[model samples]
Target: MLKEQFKQLAIGVAAFTFSCATAKAATTITVAVTPTAANAIVDLVADFVNANPTYDVAVVGSSDSLSKDAIVAGGATGPYDLLLAQSYSVPANLKYYYPTLVSGDPFPFAKDTLVLYSTTVDISQGIPLQLQAFSLPDPATADPYGVAAVQALGPEYLYAQGQSLTIKTADAGGSYAQVAYLGTAYGFTGKSQICTAVTNVDQYEPGSFHHEYVLGQDYTTDIVLAGVKIARTRTVDQETALTAFVNFLVSAKATALQHHCYKLPSAQ
Candidate 1:
């Protein structure tokens, strides 16, 4: 009788371990996003997990183009189950897994506008005489914002006129940081970025910066943001979770959060 009781106890323990492992596996989802939207995305994930306690989500953020490239390279079975990226790149990036996409469509999330930020207190002084350099994202590469910046600034005319506009380029986040902290005379970035800097200025070294809207005639483009989910190559449970998360992103609560951060929701 004692030997039989011990055998039953061992079986119960094995079953319990397997159940725990399976439950753990079912509760996690991975998402990739661009740096411009990282903060808002992180907040959204937190709220999502809180509302759905049974699930856990992780967010990975990088440059917009890089994030799209990584997801594309991963194909249908990539590390990420969903992608939040700039609107322009979504269609191209998800081309590989297009047929298998959750809805096979990209959902518009938000809109952003280009703006000019300057460390100088007054930008009305014609780009500041003390300004030795102008900084922006690289237009030749992956950044749509960079291309917009080039259209706004007309670099060729400035260069031809022998202006001391030392052109500097970096990713969007890097450009914002350089202007905010490194004393770059002028930097071009999204309006959301400038808003973030304004709200978080006290955390940086003592200084003042100003921002001006780059008119449509200047930038000649608009920025729209969107998100997409890859089809479930994992499990039906994961597919349901991904769909729910994507829906939440476009819901009123999430839209309000994005709006508070100076991003205009697509619905607007």
Candidate 2:
């Protein structure tokens, strides 16, 4: 009976040791991104984790103010080790906020085109002459895509942007919802969201296809995304893991994923 008890105790200790080792082997870092890049970041983080088992990346979607506020609030050793925002301005802004905390130029990753899409009506007429009611991201907000959408519509339609009848939301996802689900005439959204229709994906499938008008330089503003590696006091393991993930983001595979349906930073 004593021998059996001894054997059980040995197994318990072994299990605890193994568990502790497994936990130590893994290092996690957070990458705060704007909502426009959330899906792309998720896919990219998945690839990074699969390649480096020692690292786990957490993706957080932030608004313009919230994005910078989070890092500033966290200080030098913040939760966000990296930041991927809708435009290159983010890095510049960070530099202004805390010069020492931000190092190096922001990496231009991808450019997302703004698109006008509709399922309930025809938009082939080009920019609508008038809208009884419309849906869009609030142009007043600092969201790059939303501002680009307003710029695409031009001054004649500025009132339409703030009209009481229009539906305004936070990000591209909400703009998509206004038209895709809520049936709000037509709306503006990111090209990445609708590129390459997938099976059973709502509004992107064969049956629920949306008529899309791709707005290029002739119609809309350029929407490029950039990421900046933040400098923070971290453990050696965490810093190494963070460097590896950032390197992977610029890798060929990651670049392709980031540019899926969008322009490569180098391309434009």
Candidate 3:
């Protein structure tokens, strides 16, 4: 009888322990930081997660789908607790349509700089094939960076001499990816691979490719990564899951993003 009684007590204790472990409330926050934000803020996300025991963090790539999903889904169903994106789209893309989804003010996270980087192909060596020799896409149509670049080029110069540059058009992706395409298409393969590559006359041929100035016109592109513009909300559960994830990002643990390379938007 004594042995059986002890065994029962042990079983009860184990069950209680298990229940306690599983009963704790868990919160997750998702962040859709742009490429710059990814580099800058990824570290912060880690830090935030470490400090907050009850929260989890998820980082998603920006696209229209992510933004629409974050808004349309409700907090309990397709919920996202917080979002951080570029400033340009908030009122038009997010705030303007909030009534159709959750009713509340969207939280602001950070601001960022729009910087341009490139690989091979040097313009100082010789004039570009034309004033706007490089290929790019239209900002109004789809490519935000391309739009900024065009604005930087100045319409007067670009339209000069009955010549123009090409701004290739495609669905949006990452900044490095865009730079990669620019380098590869321009025949600057090798060490000068655009984003990663830099032109060195001594390192390679004299006429190597190099990234030019990053036009400030397209600060909106940074929104692509901020989870502010896009997120994954195909289902109510997904949105809820993503929201829980984003909440963690802005929490105390998110200081890690600063260490990783993400500058606080306020730093600007």
Candidate 4:
């Protein structure tokens, strides 16, 4: 009876030790990202998690808004392990406004091109002033895609300074506006948002017959997507996880996923 009790206690201790080991191996890395990358990271995190069973990725916020949140929280990364945006603005702001939060130089992972897409109007001739243009991403916020669209559309189409505008606002002509998104029927958006199967991923690449919409032009502007690590308040586990994820963003595995909606500088 004494021997049996000792054996049972040993087994229970071993099982508890195994459970602790497994729990320690699991690490979750949170990323603050722009709209496009937010959707793209779903596939990316799946692949990353597959490769490194111990790690998982969670996403939150626009690149600019999240940075503002971090600044408000103090010179820290806040809740995110990384920041991925459509331009250099995230790192640039952190560098000038809050340098201590940054871990290293930001790196571009993919290039997205702007295109005029329309399901309601024939856009072959370009910029149908008849319907006018709606607000786009705020250029003041340094959204590169919105900046490109606003710049290419010129003053006539730009109606406001922020995102999500109505036709009434476009008619009023406040300032500059973003064309792509749900509210506007016909407007400019990233090529990656439309591209599904094509592998080349050039900025000017035409959409295939399967596309639900019509193209206005060959292409407009090339937008770059960049990511950076946040150094402050990082744990030993996150230090390893962040490095692996950043390296993976630029790796061949991520290249194909990014190419689904964008072009790499080397590929271009």
Per-residue lDDT tens digits for candidate 3, residues 3-83, read: 121222212121110111111235344444433234334445555445544445555534334545645654334534444
Candidate 4 residue lDDT tens string, 157-195? 444333324233211011111222233555555555545
Question: lDDT values of the candidates?
Answer: 0.59, 0.64, 0.38, 0.53
Q: Would you give me the overall lDDT of model 2?
A: 0.64
Tens-place lDDT per residue, model 2, 168-257, is 777676776666666678777776665532232223333333444455654565677888878766778878888898788765657434
Each model's total of backbone clashes: 0, 0, 51, 7
Candidate 2 clashing pairs?
Answer: none
Against the true structure, candidate 2 reaches a TM-score of 0.78
Number of the top candidate by lDDT? Answer: 2
RMSD of each: 13.5, 12.3, 15.4, 14.2
Comparing candidate 1 with candidate 2, which one achieves the higher TM-score?
2
Q: Estimate the TM-score of every prediction.
A: 0.74, 0.78, 0.54, 0.69
Better of 1 and 4 by lDDT: 1
| Candidate 1 per-residue lDDT over residues 208-246, each given as its tens digit | 454555547566666677777765466766777777877
Roughly what TM-score does model 4 have, to 2 decimal places? 0.69
What C-alpha lDDT, on a 0 to 100 scale, does residue 78 get in candidate 2?
Answer: 78
